[model samples]
Target: MGSRRQFIKTVSASGAGLVAASAMGVMQEASAHPTSVWGGDIYSGPHEMVKNSKILSIKNPDGTETLGVVTPKGVIDVRAVAKKMKISAPLTLDQLLQEGNAAGFNKVVASADKSGVPYLDESKITYGRLFKNPGKIICVGLNYRQHADEVGMARPAVPPLFNKYNNSLAAHNCVLEIPPPEISYKLDYETELLIVVGKRMRNVPEAEALNYVAGYCTSNDFSSRDLQLELPSGQWMIGKTLDQYAPIGPYFVTSDLVGDPNNLKIQTWVNGEMRQNSNTSDFIHNTQHMLSYISKYWALEPGDIVFTGTPQGVILGMPKDKQVWLKKGDKVVSYVEKLGELKFTLG
Candidate 1:
């Protein structure tokens, strides 16, 4: 696949008349339209390729949302462009993932005359969760080599796995309604890279595991340390799986755009202070190994997300007296090399 800039050039050089005429012929043979499109809902189409582009969702005033494709000019509303051009397009990211309708979306984008369609200034739009209601929200624990050493623990022989529910998912720029102070006050931030599975697979070998990835994005495994550590059995889930705790996004760049998930630089900040800064290079179990290992027992499906572990510098790794938890009104930002910053506010 080509770079994003190169992809845009290809789209611009090809006249809309030619692209639209070709797209119209393709849409004519496609299946019937659904009664209506649902926000964050799944679609039946298989995963298909558009261009080497990033995907995201925007919140509409009516409580519904629509899908948009990131272009050099700005964010092109896929639904809007499809409507004006009269083409078949997936209305949600999950739909695109499940249906594999990238070709349809690509046609819509190609058919758009550069100046004919209206693109939204990214800041003006309220971002929605990169994905909603995925089949599984799998996570890794203590998988970063440096993080393990900092927290005073030896590297594990195998990956520690955990799970989070749908309620934990939040969008970039969204405000997290933190749990009540009485529930547990040790709120913490964990900056990690997220992996989105593109297809259904099982018993996949490490040699070709990355081929199954849909894309990569930035994420925060927002945690309540009190619930996690104070409990008798080390309630990792209770501590880690609170509502809005798994805030992700800003953009979901396709695997083609992010060639090396294991080499990106990852960092986190609280308010204006740098909190955690490290690279995925320190990951003990790299992306390919994590996916391959997890797939041994579970059939990874489209939209299934894996929260690859966070690096060192988390408050949990700080000296006992130096640790300070996140509070209401705090702004948390997480960034990965190609995946844009995932920002959110507490309270």
Candidate 2:
């Protein structure tokens, strides 16, 4: 596992640089069309984005990441195949959805699958953050019935909302550095289903909410209990949005492939031992309800993500004397039925 210093250096040198470049690209695109609004021309719509496919973010040697399509043959590097075929395609997943280029992206995937070229070896490639900079990172707290009971809190009548900034985003198989003991020693894991919105929505009905989602992924809402519960004025944002605290993906399975988002099996294992084993059926506020509720207050844009609350069996649920927080070097794997497992280690 990489140390804290190494993680910071990598983010500063590579990740931050990529963010700046991506921002520039977005600015240029927006400048070309001044009349566009947040959910207007900026969003491409769900029809183009929600195809039945698994998408991967492959890190390039040049400190940038591109989209990779997972196929039966192997992982198709979209950038490599597009270059060889002399065709136009979006370079990154963010660009694919933001620019509404899924048709072009699909064309690249279809061509690469039939070209007979040897695709990338999945085991050999480095994974990148599936989302670099989503407009919003909304989270629902205490939405699970059993989880609320375990934590000695009443089931909330409505979904309690919170937010995490882009800084907390991390990729699959990434190693996160635990804060020093003096800062926070009581680290906990909360595995939950993540919702990726494909279309722009405001005041959307619950019946039409699922239609707006682009896809789903397994995500760990890693938390620091001391910073969350023991701090003055309850610093949920500080406790929840730590660097690399939200590690999502191994793949982003489209909504068509992951039908009935609220009924999937979700689980978490720490050091290969089962910690959370429950289905999304236990959710106090189901997927569509949460989406509809949030949309009433603000517009849900393409690339915005929502983390549904976790089920019971977290370290925080145990009695004070029996609680055992996550330590450095511990491996945690989060799994959802259709979405693949997301693994990360504490540094």
Candidate 3:
């Protein structure tokens, strides 16, 4: 829930930087010879045949955004090379999911690798929101036992749900404008795992819920406790849904790459000092349970995201004398094992 002003200075020497890995799996090779695999035989229909790959948004100098694939060499500017090769590719993560362009996306990766297009150094590109536009941004509350206990609340029988709109979305390394002091005094940070829905679903069972996930990413449920708990409604939306409050990304890694979503290590830091250290294993309602429970009420479509609840160590759990609310010039970093760290500044 706290951050110091020296984040940018310390981040360079922190070695907690994002690493780009090349695309893996056979989709690249298979697409190269699609006609050779029995042209007139029974149709196998459409399916994603590759391993889950990492995708990101690269902000252009003019402020437009394009999709980039993280490779060992660097970032493959998909749109830049796709046009040069005269092949079609989605320019954003949302388009890649909503249009069912997995096959097309794979082809773009293969072409970029061979096209001699230079990879953009990670530092040279500014990140844009990982999701161009999410149809829904659902959030879960008190889903972790330790987090609930820290606030002196008993576990609820059902998963608590809340919602965030598109305006709240922010990119990794972006700057967040804290609401004027008149609006709130209690700015806090909650590190949570993000779930991205890949397919249209409703009333799904827990057994098959993972199949519907597009991928996973890191996220922060930035909050203002004064507006959240002190208001008349007693619900959390107002305090939690401020502009640039939901900072997510660095990469939207597919489920194939992220083996078990519930067992990974998750942590948060304020100005490089580790404040929260826990694993998703502490979740009271695991991934399958949360998805199944949510889909029962509303249909989840491609590009929809869900913010699973945070673990303990947030300022809200601290004693009144010890709590130091976040303020201007603070840096917050959220990290998950396979999903890279998401860093942001609060001003």
RMSD of every prediction:
15.4, 12.2, 18.4
Cα lDDT tens digits, model 1, 185-221, are: 9988999999988888799999899889989889999
Candidate models: Cα lDDT each: 0.86, 0.89, 0.86
Rank list by lDDT: 2, 3, 1
lDDT of candidate 2 over 39-144, digit per residue (tens): 2234343436748789999988998888888988889998888777765667776676666668767778889956666798999989999988888999999988
* lDDT of residue 108 for candidate 2: 86
Cα error, residue 132 of model 1, in Å, equals 1.2
Which has the better TM-score: candidate 2, or candidate 3?
A: 2
**TM per candidate:** 0.86, 0.86, 0.85
Candidate 1 C-alpha error for residue 237, in Å? 1.3
Per-residue lDDT for 127-246 in model 3, tens only?
999975888999999888999999999998889999988899999999999999999989999999999998888999999999999899999999999999998977499988999989
Which TM-score value belongs to model 3? 0.85
Compare the candidates by lDDT and give the number of the best one: 2
Clash statistics: count for each candidate:
6, 0, 0
